[model samples]
Target chain A: MKTAALILSAVLAVAACVFLLAPLVVVVLASFSPTPVFDLPTTGASLRWYGRIANLEGFWPALGLSIEVAAVSTALALVVGTLAAIAAVRGALPYADAFAALLVSPLMMPGLVLGIALLQYFRAVGFDAPLAGLLVAHLIVTLPYVARTMIAGLSRFDFTLIDAALTLGCTWRQAIFKVMVPALAPSFLIAGLFAFLASFDNYPVSIFLTDVRTKTLPIKMLQYIEEAPDPTIAAVSSLILLGTIVLLIIADRAVGLSRMAGTSD
Target chain B: MPVTSLSRRTLLKASAALAGTVAMPSIVRAAPKEIVIGGPAGAAKYFNESVFPLLKQKLGVTVLYEGTNSLTNLQKMQADKAAPKFSVVIMDDPVMIRAAAEGLIVPMQASAIPNLGKLVPGAVHLDGMWANYQLPWAGIAYNTKSGAPTSWADMWAPSHKGKVIVPSIQNTEGFWNLLIAAHLETGKPLAEAQYDIDAGFRKLKSLVPSLLNVYTNAPQAMNLLEQGEADMIGGQFSAYTLTRKMDGAPVDLAIPKEGGFAMPSGIAKITGGPASDLADAVIDAFLGPDVQQVLATKAVVTPTNLTTPRPAGYPDPATLFAPDWGFVAKERGKWAERWTTELL
Candidate 1:
């Protein structure tokens, strides 16, 4: 009975992986097609579509804007979210669970609803700066990922180690720096990764906030797809997929894959 | 779990360093001497590649094109009313009328654009607040294998039922579909179709059995046609059919003998802008006979300027019916709800 269950579980896991990765494999193959349309190449693969990616009107500026927004928002969310997590876990304020849920509520709201609401709110409040609006919107989008991961990390932590270090030889600040920070390193990495990825690929929210001079990569890609339905979008997706894989590999090497996968818990 | 014995100070330092690298310089550059134009994304590539250089040479001012859907453009215009961003806006005739009514755009002086006289009377809309440079018709786009559908009633035939895609009322083309249905049902000229809403909705409901799906946009309809999922598409833009056919797709547009609806696309000047003279010059260039001819041949739209001859393959502009866009615009909200309830 045990053997049968083990075999069934193994088969299910493999099937799940295939189901998730099949579309990605098709996208990668379509990217290399020599044709101008969205057909997979039956004869020979070509890099023509990849070559056209750089020439897409406004490609460079959009890429630059996307990276900047993602990096800045991720950094800001990490600091703010980590501090909020610490307060909720250690400070033991009244209604701490409610506070945490409020912080993460943006995740549950539909992105289009959030976008339209933000657009109307910004207009009502007389906020006209496009880049600043985009940054704030992305920060809202990314904060939940950081806060959720950090809260989980902090709940399982033992704060007694910091007190022990203080009694031994270190000051309060020194104890936090010496013990708590290193112990939460995996959480920090995982949270930052998720936060950055979320901000980088956001579309529905960015669409409402962006003006002509300021557009994110996802918005620009949508425009490209509408203007011309070609293999160039597939090429861009393939590159993004490749970059994500590299990021995941580095993450797995830094913290054991099982821990990053949250399997041990 | 065995924790790695890494120094907390080192991790903190590394994170701080990573944060530091993300700092962006907030440099404000001088605004350029450029006229900003807002329009649809599907037309942006054509404008940038073919029209910008012409505008620069003719008007001696740089051009910046911002691409977005027409409905979003209307919202943006409303939001930016205090300090309008676009020098010139391009949209369907109905949207231009709505914008004019909201005081978002200003009417043009005939003397400012002399080329306006060159266009046919039907091409001028909203009391010269805007002028239609291109006439993109809405009709049935069909696969060659569908035995060549030639009339709107062809969609309701037993053989064609369940193999047709119609645009949702939210799209400009969808509004045209409503007008066409009204025209056919009432046997009224397209101009008179606006007043018979009941007849239109009843006719639209009658065709419900033919619908494969109601698409919300042009691209989705085009995709369905390209994939052969639908044998014919109702209220599709002729330009998209032309583009697909040029790309080797076995598709052709059919402007039924009952007549198709002509959607006049035009450019309007925003109420306040520093580049009014340049914007006027650009609009005139767009209306020039040579430019109109180029638009007809290259973009597959019917030219509005009478002097510019029609392209060989396209339907004649005079033959297509013109719906009352102003009336349609005013009644669109209630009609859209009716469409959803009765048709979809």
Candidate 2:
């Protein structure tokens, strides 16, 4: 009976992995298809679709904007979210639970609602700057991921470690930079990854904010599909998937994936 | 370890510089000679690839193309009505009527756009608020392998059961399909049948059994037909299917004996736009003979310019039907509700 249960569990795990990863596998294979239409490369593979990606209208600028917005928003969210999390967890402020909920409330709201509301609010405040508006909007999008992860990480932390560092002749700032930060390194990496991805792929919110010249990668991909339904978008998707995998591998090397996933200490 | 730290520091500095550059106001502000236009992605792609360079060479005016759907472009114009960013806007006929009603677009003068007189009859709005650039007719698109449909009534045939795709009422193609169904059921002319909403809904309900699915996206529906997953797609556009056919897809659009409806792609000058003359020049360029030829051959759209020759093997413009878009704009919401509750 015990052996049967183990086999069932292993089968279910494999099934779940296949279910999650099947679409990605199909997309990657479709990217190399010889035909223009989206299909698996059963007959043969070609690099023609990948070659077309660079020449796609407004592609390069869109890619540059997406990376810049994602990197900046993720970095800002980490600092602001970490400080907000610390205040909620350790500062013993009034309505601490309420504050944390409010901090993550944007996640509960639908992206469309948030986008329309932000667009209207920005208009009312006379904020005409497009890039700044997009950055602010992305900051709203990414903050929840960082805050939720950091809050959870900080809750599990022991405050005595900071005290012990200070006792060993370290300054108050040094205690945080050396001891606390290094201890929560896994959570930081995980949070940053999630935050960057959330900002990078955001569409509903970014759609309202993007102007003629300022568009993100996801918006550009959708436009390409609209202009012509072909395998070129599949090539772009494959490259993005490969980029994400590389990021994951680097994170794994720096801090074990098991720890980042919170399956182990 | 030192190398790693140096690289990390450099990365931080680079990011900070990027953020600063994005936030900073431009120190060198030149007198702008650009006109911004809003349209669908496909149209924008065509203009950017084939038309914008010519505009720059001839008039020395740069074109900034904003690509999105018709409704989003309308919304953007509405939001920026006080000081509209788009000098010209391209949208479907129904949405252009709405834009006219909302005063988002202004009428064009014949003196300003010399090519306005060169368009086919009924191509320009009666109020001269907008003009059609390209004509995409709605008809039955089918996989050649599954054989061809000859008339609108052929959609109800037994042989095609569960092998047809119809557009959802949200799409403009859906409006065309509903009108066609009404015409067949009521035995009225296409224009009068558009008002017979009950007849349209009743006929469309009977078609539900023959339908594989209702599609909101046109390209995805065309893909299904191209892959032979579905035998026929109702209310598919001529330009879209023809483009796919040229790419070697086994798809062909048939203007049945009952006649197909014209879904004209229209352009208008935005009210309160900064560059009014530039907008007029751009509109003139779009309607000119050379641009019309490019649109017909490369974009696979039927041109509105009277002088431009139609692409080989395309049906005569006289065979296509044109609906009263003003009525469509008014009754679309009511029709959409009935369409959803009954047909869907």
Candidate 3:
């Protein structure tokens, strides 16, 4: 019975993977297909659409925009989020639970609502239609990831060393930077990765804030797809989706996915 | 440089790009031949039927349909000058005129497609674009349970306060509705539609608190109506046909007394793309008789060519109200800004 159940589970797992991955596979195929629409068997195979992607003017700028936003957001999230986590774990604040909850609030809000709300709020506060607005909006949504990761890293950290540092008369700031930071380096890195992916893939906030010059890849893709639904979208989306997965794989390979997984929780 | 020089760690990334290139359709271009058409996929089907066939028989070229939304297609045409990708763009009139002003489209000789004479008056020669298609109907759509709303004013009846839905005034249709609603509230014709704008804005603002959702797309709201989620909302002339087609739902299009809103879409010639001639061929097909018959059956979308007959179970286009296209074009941006401020 157990063996039968195990076989069933394996089949189910494969089926689920196929269900999730087939559309992506078909899209990858469709992106390269000669025919404009997805239909019956084609003559053989093709690559003109991918070439079209390479040649499209929006391709490079959008990709660069996505990468830059993700990188900046991740780096800042790592630093600020790690510090917050270390401080809370060190028992620096009263009502730390409330503070932690507040830090993670952006994660609970839907991206679309958060984007529009930020747009309206920022406009009312006089920061509308600018790159600074996009950055600030992105920062708010990504801060929670850093803080959440930092919290886990802090919990797993060896506090005795910090206690010794306190006994040794080192400043709290000095101990945090020199001692606490190294112990929680893995968590900080994991948080940074999460923040980068979130910012990189973010469309709602990016689209709202994006003007002519500040447009990101996803926004360009949205604009193009809305104007023209063709095989080019499959090619572009596949490129982005694969880029993200590859980035995740690199992160997992370089630093243990488990440490990040633990920190993620 | 050899692709092998790519970082060993980034091989996966390198392979993906290479694989993408390897899989593209192998259609050879001997002398740079293709017809690049930019329009909604539904709009592009005429390319398959009318234009592509004619292009092959006459010009000896294949066409690529770049099915997309109205706004960005125009932007793409503007950007692609040196080596154009699209030969023709079938899009909304506002974008087409905007492109013409921007000098994105090449001016056409009246000698070509003499069928321009069949188009409605406002659809005639603009700076560089011409109206080849139009949707001369727009007004509030109500839940069948709310009874027929014969005019725009009935949508504001106290009963619909909690259930009322309106399209997002951010889109072109939304601003168009804003202009029409303003005119309807004051009981004016299209020429006098502008005189009573402020009263309409103020009246529209009052319903802000009661709105359930600001819908963006037309078809999506029609779905909500069939589900019985909306008591009243804005819609196209053909909302009734789609609902009736799907399980005999009693949803219907309401032609308001002040005359249903008039909005027309136009086709602009893009300088880029080898397939432009094909795009023209498609436009010719759109004006042809075959597709118009199919279009009529689906919805009450008015075909541009006056020669075509109305579909069975659809209203005659003659009965619907039409506003000044030139005036609407001029006022679109300002009205859009107002809508953003007032409705969004």
Q: Considering every candidate listed, which one attains the maximal DockQ?
A: 2
Model 3 CA deviation exceeding 4 Å by range: A1-265, B1-33, B40-69, B81-83, B117-123, B134-136, B217-223, B235-251, B271-273
- Report model 2's interface C-alpha RMSD after superposition on the true interface residues: 6.2
lDDT preference between candidates 2 and 3, better one: 2
Two-chain DockQ for model 3: 0.03
Instruction: Report the TM-score of chain B alone for all candidates.
Output: 0.87, 0.88, 0.77
Tens digit per residue, CA lDDT, model 2, B55-79: 8887898888887778778988997
Sort by lDDT, best first: what order?
Answer: 2, 1, 3
Deviation from native of the Cα of residue B234 in model 3, angstroms: 2.3
Candidate 1 Cα errors over 4 Å, as ranges: A29-47, A92-99, A154-183, B1-30, B56-64, B145-147, B183-197, B289-294, B306-309
**Candidate 1 residues B131-216, lDDT tens each?**
99898777889877675678888888888778899877766888766777787899987777768988889898989988889976
Best by TM-score: 2
- Candidate 1 chain A: minimum summed lDDT over ten consecutive residues — where? A34-43
Q: CA lDDT of each candidate?
A: 0.81, 0.85, 0.63
Cα lDDT over the full model 3: 0.63
TM-score of each: 0.86, 0.90, 0.53
lDDT of 2 at B4: 63
- The TM-score obtained by model 2 is 0.90
DockQ-superior candidate, 2 or 3: 2
